[model samples]
Target: MFGYRGLTISDDGILEISGVRCDYLVEKYGTPLYVFNEEEILNRIKEIKENHIVKYGGVAAYASKAFLTKYMCRLIKREGLWLDVVSGGELYTAKSVDFPMENIIFHGNNKTYEELEMAVDFGVGRVVIDNFDEIDILEDILLKKKRSIDVQIRITPGIDGHTHDFIKTGQVDSKFGFPMHDESALHAVKRILNSPALKLKGIHAHIGSQLHQNNIYKLEVEVLAKFISSIKNLFDYEIEEINCGGGFGIYYTEGDKRLSISYFTDVIHKAVEECFSRYNLRKPTVFIEPGRWIVGEAGITLYRVGSIKDIRGIRKYVSVDGGMTDNIRTALYSAKYTAVPANKLNNKDEEQVTICGKCCESGDILIKDIKLPKLERGDIIAVLSTGAYNFSMASNYNRIPRPAVVMVNRGQDVLIVKRETYEDIIKNDL
Candidate 1:
């Protein structure tokens, strides 16, 4: 079980995360507040190590797409973990925090010319290349710069992860990576092997995210091992790394079940060790990118309940000050989330209400038919497990301002990301 340290749930049902009460955060930062637990984030990193670090010497990188800030980068970096950056903007953020270039692994299926050029110039440690086009792009850039770039070719591996189809990248039909059955993929491997300007270092594959089973990853490793082995035999070449890609799921709702980090580690370890021993394969350094599990449960989004209307013939609507503009998962993925009355902490459960966002779209529903204590205008509601995709995916829809993000550690709470103002929206406009 993932336990939240420095937090307590009072008998009155009030939730205090990292010594800072959710109610207090609402009062201080206003509605649509994002509260993060500093300790819990680190704890997740430790969980990965506890569960799997010993096997083939595993290393973990916090997937920045899950939610990123300079301080968040520093926190993860300080804990001695690597980072996975997907774009130039994310890479720029990592650089802003002075993240070590050697520890950053650049990942993207369609990296732009400028992004690739910038990464190479910046000297990023590893580039996780997705397609043959990208292979050509990187080689072109390296030839021009007269520099050799360390690269990892991403293979489809045909592993359809048990998650939303849109987010799964390992399936053959997906937009990411080279498909295994396609002869073009073998040609891609040979191309990388022959390219003197690009050093082909490894194979990368992401099974998917929000995954619930460890066996899925076990199968991924098994398949990846065979893929790498075949490449070695065919090309007489060897790479030194195997990036498993991160999609480890965190507990969202009470009914959600996730494997312990140790269990996840053991499964991968057994798979890798067995394969290498059986094939007499050379062991390569293992890398994983876990995003949500690190920060999802550590975050709580606090929103102030606005007006409440009971439509007798229809469903009751309790509008919040912010909505899909700030956290679009509900509207986008039909993603389910849990919420509680932050201000009415000690109150008993008394109402079933549909929590809607202030976004103009009716699809801006946050939680549908959520049970809560008797609600009042101005009361604050805290939504749990939003640390992953909320801020990273927030948009200016309805022209609403983005919410602030804060880190709560020990008894101190500090703002890490400030809420956007109306001026921020029109800054780029004429």
Candidate 2:
């Protein structure tokens, strides 16, 4: 059974995503391709809009770091969702698509001088200030441009979301934001308030990724609300927006549970309303920056199984054409995923196999010890729930060019990003 909508197994056991057959896509786009179900993405966005943005009077900013391309920018813009960009390259991608400048929320921990200047010049709607040094740099850029920009100070509320240590960001000891336990956040707030070029718009915090607990989000709201109230009492500056950064989890494997959109949105809205009311502060425009939750399940990566190494009394290694080069999550975070032999979906014969990548590193395994229909050397393998960070975090590791990305809908597939070539690898080397 597929965890996400738009995926089906044909009568002959072929896997079809949004009505498009996996083997057909593999033949057309080649192996190691990223196929996103456009309908599923739209459905997720619709859930955000209807449940959170429209229902709660908030904003939905699609976290572009999850997956970004010119086509994706156009899709987000068309759906009327704001974009959260973390780097200059992402900003440029949005700009190249002629996306509305004001709908952009720029974020970066160590935003370079040029990146800040670029954001300022492009008239980004809000810049989430990550640290004290970035504050000075941004103010200088704004002063030079003789323009002011609305900004939000990212605060580490010290709430651990009980996720991966590498992805947990809102903790006090993290390198991301100004810690609230000390005077650093207050100092940063004061600095922003004093600067004529920067307008303090709100407070922001992203606790972690792949979060499932609702209590953690409620607790985050409480912390942010108290901080907002204190800032109002101290500086007499009322924050107008509250960006409870997004980490809504999605299903990756059978063990993973995906919560409903309202499950998070309703709790978030109620928490905001209750906490602000208790604090005697007006409710600000809430913002949710969801990345994985929006597109994770909508995506499936197709790879060609090659060179099966069956070591008796050991593990059978079913190697694919792609590995860390296409998806580093498994190796990076020890992430779990669900994969099947696309060509043999109806076959009942199964064996435990380790889906390894062509990369030289022993750690470049995709799924370890998973039962699948007996995998053949030329069979196509489909790994689900890869839409979020796979393409965005892909690398040319081991000199393997990144795979092409295609958006599939209603049995139609269109390439959004072309497959990289060896020339592209060396294009910047000389």
Q: Which model scores highest in TM-score?
A: 2
Residue pairs clashing, model 2 = none
Candidate 1 lDDT score at position 191: 90
lDDT string for model 1 (168-222, tens) is 8888898888888867678888898889888888888888888888898888888
lDDT agreement with native, every candidate: 0.84, 0.92
Per-residue lDDT over 325-384 for candidate 2, one digit per residue giving the tens place of the 0 to 100 score: 899999889999999888888888889999999989999999999999898889999999
TM-score per candidate, chains pooled: 0.96, 0.99
lDDT of 2 at 389: 94
**Best candidate according to lDDT:** 2
- Candidate 1 residue-wise lDDT at 349: 64
- Give, for candidate 2, the lowest lDDT window spanning 10 residues: 1-10
Q: Where does candidate 1 stray beyond 4 Å?
A: 1-7, 10-13, 54-56
Evaluate model 1: give its lDDT.
Answer: 0.84
